[model samples]
Target: MSKQLVVYISATGTTRRVAQNLAKAIDADLAEIVPAPPFTAQDIDWTDPTSRASRQHADRAMRPPISASPSVDGYDEIFVGYPLWWDTAPREVRTWLESHDFTGKTITTFATSSSSTRGALGEQLHDSAPDAHWVNGRRFAANASEAELKAWADSIA
Candidate 1:
């Protein structure tokens, strides 16, 4: 079994595509952190302050319930993927992180975003799993290539 795992949450499917490619490239196991009551198209609307995403992003304490835990046992390294939502990962990531044991593991974060910056991810992720070794993360364009993903995974390995 591969020691590495590629786990991610994608509300709009873009991050899911990237996660699939990254897992294939690195020959790692893959898992998705799904949100319970699942997100409707309207729930992701950033423009509406009343939207589910907007409400969650506006508040720090909202840890959205995930469907289940993607057990992290036996993995030495994990690459966490997500879309850069409101300058950080969606709150469901917090739900996923809290469910796992990351001690002695290395976590490298990567995200897909329309913005030029990777946004405020490192601190949030580190804060979620303080015992895990966190590394510098990268932001990828929506059109990021498979080769580029492979290269990044190889470098981390």
Candidate 2:
């Protein structure tokens, strides 16, 4: 059985790359946090205020619907990853977390960012899965290497 699970949401494939590398490094299961309708390029355009991504970021209470929640029954460690949007995770991640029961699991977060750090993600996402144990999360560059990802995973473990 896989002890670790790596789940991520990547609108433009950046975070998906990181999550895939991390899962391979740790020999974990992988899952994608897919949006119900799936995002188009125009919907994720950061420069457009009317974009779906922009509207979700502007409203803190928003929880964008996910197509399906991943099952977390046997994993001891769960890694949640996403692209850093407005210094936090996309709201769809929150919806994914809220959909699962992670009372005894260790929840760790990671993000892909161009320049911003993954700021206070555990604190920001606490209410969604308040019962799980959360560890400090890291932000990585788009081209972060396999060695770097393994090292980070070792340190966190």
Candidate 3:
């Protein structure tokens, strides 16, 4: 079996937990895609749609900086985790995806969201990395079971 890597960008900690669960199941390396400066509570103002962060997201140009870049070489399978924002991925995820090369590798995505469907996020990932063999995306509640996530990861492998 080829080595696997789980890369995640989390906002509310839900995605981070999911990523860790999946990584443990597959014995994969876990890499957190932390934004350079990090987002403050004020920057996430989900309550105020007129906030700067919200406005930048509305314009589809909210590219938050990343603190570290993950190495994709030697990993045949990559599992990416994130929270669904604005019916898609967070801007930092875009930065991470664009920063790496996944040629000839299998890419899987999982997301956690309160309202949005996983299909939308999966489609967005497919669009972003057209050459990648994107698999079905999964959605779980904030308090999902570790066994459930492990089973899902095993099925994909």
The candidate that achieves the highest TM-score relative to the unseen native structure: 2
Error of 3 at 67 (Å): 1.0
Against the hidden reference, what TM-scores do the models get?
0.92, 0.94, 0.87
**lDDT tens digits, residue span 70-113, model 3:** 87889888888887766677777777877777778888888888
What lDDT score goes with residue 7 in model 3?
90
Candidate 2 regions with alpha-carbon error over 4 angstroms: 118-121
The residue pairs that clash in candidate 1, if any, are none
Worst 10 residues of 2 by lDDT: 118-127
lDDT of 1 by residue, 1-157 (tens): 3499988888788888888888888888999988897778898788999987799888988888988669889999898988877778888988888778899988888888777364534567778888898887788776677789999877766
Q: If the candidates were sorted by their TM-score against the true structure, best first, what order would they fall in?
A: 2, 1, 3
Cα error, residue 19 of model 3, in Å, equals 1.1
lDDT of each: 0.82, 0.87, 0.77
Badly placed stretches (over 4 Å) of model 3 are 50-53, 118-121
Error of 1 at 136 (Å): 1.6
Residues 26-79, model 2: lDDT tens digits: 889999989988988987788999988799888989988888678899998999
User: For model 1, what is the alpha-carbon lDDT of residue 15?
Assistant: 82
Candidate 1 TM-score to native: 0.92
**Displacement of the residue 74 alpha carbon in candidate 3, Å:** 1.2
